[model samples]
Target: MSIDFLKKYFFGDVQSSSDVSSVAFQQSALRILLALTLCIFLVSEVHFLFTAGDYSFLAINSVYLAALIGLLYLSRRYEKATAILFLFTLVTASILLLTLSNEFHAEKYALISLYSLPLITRLLFTFKASIVAMVANLYPFYLITNNSWMGSAEFLDSANLLTSADALAGASIAPSFYFQMLTFVTLNIGLPLAVSRIIQTLESHAIKMKDLNQKLNSHYAMYEEFFENTGTPSLLCDQRGKVLKANQLCRHLLTGGIKKSLAHSNITDWLTPAGENSRFAWQSDMAECTLKSDSQTHINIRRASLTEHGHLVIHLENTTELKAIQQELESTQETNSRLAHFDVLTRLPNHRHFCQQVNQRLAEHDKHVTGAMFIIRISQFKLLNKQYGKDNANKVILSFAKTLTHKLSDQAVVGRLRGVKFSCFIPLSQTYLIQKNLSELIKSILPKQITVEGNKLNMEYQVGIAYYHTDGKNAEALLERCEMALEYSNSVERFSFYNNNLENKLIEEHTLGLSLSSAIKNKHITIWLQPQVNASGDICSFEALARWQHNGQYIPPPQFISIAENLGLLPLLAENLVRALVETLTDWQKEHIHTPIAFNLAGQELMNDGFFAFLMALVTDKPWLKDRLELEITETSPVMTHPLVHKRLRSLSQYGYSIAIDDFGTGQASLGQLVDIPANILKIDRRFVFPLPHDQRHVDIVKSTIQLAKSLDMKVIAEGIETKEQATLLIAMGCNTLQGYYYGKPSPMTDWTSHSNAKAKTLRMVY
Candidate 1:
């Protein structure tokens, strides 16, 4: 077994012992004494039985040796009990040997064994046990020496005790022997106990020192790692500002300085005057300072005391990058502020800035003081952009702004309000002179033309003026009035002034637009059908036109139609008209009349896929109505070029519905453009059809249009056939259909129903 296991088995868990070292020392002493006792007894037994032929003394020595061996075995299980037993055994052996020496007259051997008992007992047991064993062993010596005890004892008389010459000699020397024995007892017990205590104290002190040394080593390692690996530059300094130690980061920071190593260097040499003064207090919890080295490098220093002995720990953190970032952020903020107030392209104040300036000026105005604002808009600017591209177009606008600003310097404040529109604010006193000057400036600039990429481009402008205190009292009101005047100005007139009539007209138009949604919802919009006739004068179909009547007065179609388009209500209006016409056709079907009805599709309605889907869904269950339905499209519709419009028209035509191009001649569409449109009929404009046979120009135009329709394999329908002569001329010109007053004026479905029935009957009779 291992030594630790053996110690635990003999000592019964040394940690549980009050003092482990003391217990270990006592155990070692007990084993050594026990072995010595056994050896001494064995030698004595051999001498007595073999050399002297003494059986009694030999048997006693054998018993003593066996007891010592038993003690050795018992010590493993019960150390304290075995220790007491060993001490008792030592005392018993001494007493027995002494008694035997008296019985056998071998006093010299007995005295020698008894003399070592005190030293062995004191080393093995505690003080009290050692003293008690010594006293008990002394009683045997007293009994051997005292004659009275021998006489009183009956066993002593029967034992035949003899007094040899050696015994007499021992008795005569007993006084001096007792003195020496007493001195030996005192020295062995007291000296061994004192030495054991001293040894225990030394062991305890050594253990504590070892533990303290381990703790110090662990702390030192942690401190070393922290100082060397930390990113912040650090240093240790004394009370006099002398540097004691510096970490790796601190050494790197001071590499290029006058003193390469910070150790033993005065800290004041590196710090500014303010920093050195701040450190004079030394007791401050924390202080910040700046360090400018001899190399001109800047360092931010943070210092604090590490110990009460006036030791300071300094940390350095570089802030150069942080300062640079702050400067960059400030620059970006300035740029953003500039962008917010001024236009980046033209370098003029933006619309918002202009509005703010105008409001500020108006707030500073006194009563009776007046100012004028002009909104100058470029004419055909979109066309110019398309011709020269956006870059050259912007150049022209920039040139115009620069020239205008130079001409009106100090007389007005000008700003670009929006694309192709510039706004100017000036005192009313200078309005006439500024206006004349602007007119002259534009005239001179137009003739010279704006040169962009070596190309000369001509531009035109129109101006609208609104005077404050007369047109408006605020910036928004003035700008709105100026826009109305600009829209109402004639093309020939380059400028116009805001008047009360234009404002009143705008209010009326706005009011009409607001009521249009309710009119459509209430079904006040009705369809008026104009009949179309073939060459034989038989009615073929009727064209459905939208009519509105409100409060017993009929509103003109042109006025309300434009209003509806501007208000983005064209889809709703077209759907209402289509529903009315479908209902009228349904009624005609119930009356056994199956005439196709054509309805106009607005530009916005054609582009709206949702409305087209709604129309298709309405006729899904009434598939037969597709054959009697015709959709007419204006050639000038902006949505005509849209892909969705082309897709819907083709889808409708594939579903057996006829598509017709209305007012074909007046629109800008050419024959090539019409070729892609899925149209079955081309309607000749009313202007060409109205003058009929008498106006040869009109006659030739209609004839040529009819010929064009024939070439495209499309039927030509002549509109505005007011007279029989007009109808006759259209038919002779090879027009397939005639639609106008010659057939029947546009009337409600009820009036057209009766007229259509009479015409059908008359045509049947003629046939």
Candidate 2:
């Protein structure tokens, strides 16, 4: 149990009683005192107890010796052990002072233990505490040495036990001995003061030096953070260009997203040979150099050395794009000069260049050699331009130029003369004239139709021929002869050679145009109704077409319409067509037949104030006309997009008139037009409908148009559906309205029965 107690007492979490600063002094004093008490004072106590026959003191000394062994520890954790040892020694000394050291009698070891209390306290505690110990010990010490305070017989006995004959020799700490011990006190106190002064100076220096080192470390840490976060492409390297540390941008610029180790990498690896050579010779503290990288990029590099033999910071600025921009400015004028000789619309040679080259060819030809000049003119081009707008007209001209160039050989001269006309000069090289055999070649070129904005147009043209050396000498004279031939072709409506009888053909055309104006005034213009059917073969509506049979000859609609536009008779034609349409629908109404009829309206007819008022007044009183009337504005109307024209159409639509875009998918038609215009029906043009179920591109166009109409809550009608297969494919693609000649051709109103078609609705607009 004692061994267990000693083990726990020395090794457990014990607390120290002394102050933190004096703990080392307290422990050292306890160790030295414990050793001496056991070696000298403890041994002397045992001898004195035996000699004085003091068995009580001997028993107490035996227990103290037993406790001293257990209280001692070898480890440095001796705070609690030191406190317990000091307290135990003071308790033992007190016990001896109270029991053995009295006024009458005292034991010798007890007197020695009490006198040593001052010395132990001075070593273990502060000097003030030791002075209090000495004050307390003074009374007990005096009691042991007081000779008269004890009886003479007892005093003599105590003196005889200690081998002292005189009373002064009875105690070891005598008055005379204290006086002598005081003589050496000055040396002991002076030596401790001298050593304490030296220790104070050393501790003060250590504190200041420790603070200085902490401040230096803080400044270095801030410097490192600033170096790593520098914004430029900076690097820390030796003067020889061996990289130690580089900022993030510098690493990424050199390595291009690859994570390469920093060890032994040099800036010279990415430089060109010239740049690498320049870097080796660089010596200034700061220098600017233009370095070319291996990637062929120019870099304006600026470098500065941070130290005499360590680290260089470099910044790279790219100058490749700037240099290229400077070079482009030098060549701009040459490009402009070359472009000046070509036509802007078609990029073909202009009239000036064409004439100059043709005159040169005439100069080169021998007197026997011959070449022919052919001038080609697009028919009704004025109407074509008015119907489809200038942008689409430009597309047609450009397409014509490309097709003409593709058909002819490279040596043949082809050029755009001016608006809707082109010239080609083919020279004859042999006795057989190529000009006489060139009609078949011209026929082949004519069949290659021009497609403008997805609508394919027939390339109908009239070509006038004039032979060089037979007609005139140079380009100007040959062109004049060609123009005369062109005038004859315009009147006769066929390709013509140089002729002198051009006025007779013009007289005949003039007679026919006069007959057309009389037909409009005399109400000779008539309309025929063609049925538009749905996918189920049920009739939806009828398209009203203008027809004329004058002088027992059938004039095509396109031929007469172009003549009417030139004569300014479109409004008069529109008035006649509307009257015929009402008559047809009124006759059908009396027969109990009802179906909607639509007709084309040109932009010129809609914008005429007098005609617009007449049409609106006719439908204003007849409220039932809303169910039977539908107005179809031609998609190729020249002024269809004008604000006043759109206003008129929208007013008609607001009055419950069914409106549709006629001949759609041509001439600037787009998805945006369908959304913005106030129309309910999008009629697909015949060009797209004619190629359906065969041409994949046209099929996709029809399919997408149907989907777009359905998405916008509009009905889609596809015309020119000639085959049942085409109708079935359109129905499968989500279109229900279909119309074409496969259903029916345009016929008289009396031809349709009351049961087969209940009612025919009329929507007439003059085109």
Candidate 3:
């Protein structure tokens, strides 16, 4: 091994200054002490063999040398155990060597070696272990001093003989021996203890310095890494604005590339000041500066002190792209603000914006400044859309908006309130004049023969006006009053003003709606059946009709039905009516009556899938009820055009419930709708049937309707047969079923049962 390797192996690896008192240090110190002891033993053995020709001292040294070698070998494997074992060996070997030396007349050398034991143990081990080793080593010396073993001849003779003749010739050896022994004890034990304490204090200071140096190195490494790897451009400069050190990013940003050293270069030479005072400052604490480059690029430079000696750190950030992005963000915000206040299609104030403006004006206006709000509703707009399509309809609406904007630009604020509806706020004094002007503008801008997409269309509108503070105080209230006035206006009436009478009627309608909703829930609405008879005058089926009586006065069907529909309570009313019909049918079933009863369904009821599903669930277990049930729907119901409603109707038909189209001729159902609808029976409207046999036009229409129904495989039943003549005419016209006052008016189930029994008895008598 190399000298360095050997040193490391025998002692320890080079320890940091901070680790001088660590376990490795202690072990290295112990190993060195043991090595020195081995060298001393070798020197003593050679000296004794050459000068005194005594092999005993050499043998003692040999035994100790072997133990030291073993301790050294063990030190590499188990340092702590080896250290303790070495201390014990030192104490034990000292006692053995002292005894052997006394036997060989070498008491002086033995006493010297024994005195070193406590010092070696204390230096290498704990104070307690050293004390125990010192006591153990003193046992031999105690025996020699007390003459405990001198009674033996061998010990007495060895003790009497001295290594030097001068000591042996002395008259009394005790005093001289005592002086030499005391001197040896002081030098060996006291010197080692004092020296060891000094070494320990020095090691403590070394450790503190090593720790401080390591901490400094760590901090420096962190700063170096941050300087080189930080994404931002950085430079370390002196007070003169000269670059002392720069990171890679700083080089690339300032000089394009690191082709040459940037050391001691004046930083201000490459940058122009953004302000009028374009001079570089020599003194700096912390400041932000804007600098422009040769390529017209803008840079933000932050200069801050890095050291007490006026060294500064400069950070560079490019602001060109950031400024562009900020500009784009501001532009986007502006566009969004505009969109929030104006309609995207017409670029006019929208409903929310219009309401805000009106509210602001109302808050600012005095009581003397009376203003009026006008809501212009485009009539037949839905029909126009249906005919010309949405694209052209939008074009027409846009044209109307443009006309309003142009005509009322100076006099009022105009806005598109909602679909096909526009609003204008103008002075109440000029209301009449504005209305007249608008009428003329409407006539001129929206002509009767206006052509769009090669199709001529007639445009019409209705205008409703509500005066501010008189009709309402806020925008919402004014708008609601305008809508109410518009609703009350007729097709012929182009404009109307808000009035108190309309509000009273609305209150009455709302009151009626509440009453109807309660009546439906309480099952006060009763079912009345109108019988439909065959040509033989035999009652075949009864059509179910809903009748409501409140406080002994019957409410008309049209009024209550309209009220129910508007209140969104039509489904509840329909369900209660169906329940009554089913109960009546169940009674008939119990009496063995197989007659099917038809119930009317409104358009809204037909659209409710839940209603049909409820009916199916109610009669799911009663196959007889399903067989005897019939559903009658008006032909004009908008639900008939819906594919989902049509599917549900077909499903009901498949479930064995008869489906009928009532008042067929009164509705505007297309031929295709009539064909596609799943109906087993078609009831000709009473309008045509009431004038039957008298007007040939009515007669011809009924006959043609019956022929159409027959061709479609549907049974034709003529309704409103109030006379035998009408029934006879319908029977002759291929209509086998008739329903009207001629047979029986709609009556309660009990009354209908009595009339049906009476009719049955009369028919029996005739047969």
Candidate 4:
């Protein structure tokens, strides 16, 4: 047996004496047999010792050795080898008991052989062996007790004498019998009890082993389950790196079948060529790869080394969505860039991008034939803008750009340079063929009316062509020449080319904007008051006009008005004019002037809420002239933005203050708006007034406007009447009210008061 099995079997504290005793017992039994055999041999030799020749059969001792060999073999192979060994010892002890009793006439000392039975059983077997040992010891003792030696012992003890040899032998036998009883008690009772305790300990060990095995089996089952069901392509492998178990996910990931082994498949074979050498020895790295399958997918391959199992895990994260997101972001960025460089309303290249394009095109002019930049500007667009709001103005600009785009082909680069100013680049080779057609196309597109918010607006555009290498080459020079031509176009009736005279016009406008502030402060501005006549042929109000007295010359109102508006001096100028009017009207009222005096308000002034309050504060300070003071709002002023101004105007009107709509027909005013506006007087625009004498359309509009004003309890006044014929035509067209050069031109307060007093005498005579 192995040393481990031997160690388990010999778990006791035994001495060498006990071992030698066991060997002596075995030799004694063999010696007893030998003695029996010798006795038989002597009997055979002597031939006259005893008469039972059949006793020769009992002398053969080979059966004992044969049984010994058989028991030894059984002990080696039997599952309960301990019990079998104990049985063999018990049989040997029983044989000794029976042979000694029979041969020695049931001697009480024969029971001593049973003493070895308990030792043999307890050493080799468990509690079951102890029971067998008890049977062996007790059965022999019973037989010996019932033998004639026991009866003889009893009779000898009863006689209580040592006279006969039988009695003495019986007495000896009685002591021997008592000794056997003691040995039987020690072996059968005490040894069986000790063996039973040892068997309990062995049973405890067996229970503990069973519990340990159960725990091991449970843990094994749990690990088995985990390896089978783990969803992230799991693999359980042996120490040799051979796959022990593969989960469903792992099978699907690797080859879609569990029959094929993962051990022979190289991980690199499943990945794209880009990921062949991408493995990191220590940890992980991102690798973009395409799967080797029908699916066209990009994945980020990640690997983790599992050193415990000598395995590696590969996770493929599809990055197709991330790439799509990146692509969409790039597209959005490009679109935003395009919007920045191009006009949102017109969809044309804006000023900054146009300049860059021009520079790029010019840089490639080494072998070019020629190129020209035409700065196409809308002429008198400010008139359209003043008539309509910016919303309509934007629509007009869009329409103009579209027209320009249609006129020009791929060769031409067009851009919205600025407000109402567009640039067109034309190759010189095609400029000639396109020049006339381009001008005609611009005119055709411009004159057409554009409807915005149901307001049809007539607008116009002017083109100014400045050729490179002929007119100018550089961006600044070319733009300057084109702008000059645009200015020249404004002076003439139609589109015009840039000539040397264009500089003089720019110098004039520049000089005007620079000198205007000084001119207002230095009394260089002449004030003219236009009379407002009621239906009774009497002066109702007078509109104060600003005429620039420039170096002993007169600058027309249009020239200085545009300059003041552009330079942002219009508000200051308007304030000064209002203050001047208050002073002028205050003095006139002192002189018994009963006519109302009005100061013109610009659209820019109307945008300032404080401006109307300032005017009201001025009037409040001068209470005596309040009744004679009137405020004039031009139709061009953005009335929609000034709701408070309208309310204040209405309050002023309730206090007997008069309001007038100056340059009436020149702006966007409907009959509906006029009915609601706080106005007591309407001034017919000069254009309509000038054409009233000849044009029936002008006369009809004038008649309708006059009648409408009278119906609204407002007096209508016709302006710019430089001739009696125009005045007579206005008077005959049911428009008796008039204010122009024919009545008396706009003059200084001194000249105005003088002319007005003289005209009062004439009106008194006519009445």
Question: Which candidate comes out best when scored by TM-score?
Answer: 3
| Candidate 4 local lDDT, 162-265, one digit each (tens) | 44556444545587568668878886677668766765675577567667767888999998787676556555443333455556666666563435566655
Candidate 2 lDDT over residue span 1-767, tens digit each: 88766444433323333122344445655666666555654685669665975576677767766665545553146655565566556557656655565432444445445555655665566556556656675566456445434455555564553334454465653754465244223223333344344444654565676577678878888876777677766666667867777777667656654787656876566544233446663343433344333365555555665666556666555566876776786667666554666677777767777788888876776778777778888886787799899888887887788878888776667778888888888776554255556556566765457777788787678898887787778877777778878876764556677744554555666787899989988978777778787777878787888887878977888777767777888888988887767766666566555666887777788888988887787688766666676778787766777789888888887788888887777945555457546889889998998887889999998888889888878888888889988888999998868888888788865555344343332222211
TM-score of 3: 0.68
For candidate 3, what's the RMSD?
8.0
Residue pairs with colliding backbones in model 2 are 593-758, 593-759, 594-758, 594-759, 594-760, 595-759, 595-760, 595-761, 596-761, 597-761
Candidate achieving higher TM-score, 2 or 3: 3
**Per-model lDDT:** 0.73, 0.68, 0.74, 0.64
Error of 3 at 93 (Å): 13
RMSD each, Å: 10.8, 20.3, 8.0, 16.8
Worst 10 residues of 2 by lDDT: 758-767
Predicted candidate 1, C-alpha RMSD: 10.8
Per-residue lDDT for 519-576 in model 3, tens only? Answer: 9888888888788888898878888888889778999988898788878777888998
Question: Of the candidates numbered 3 and 4, which has the greater lDDT value?
Answer: 3
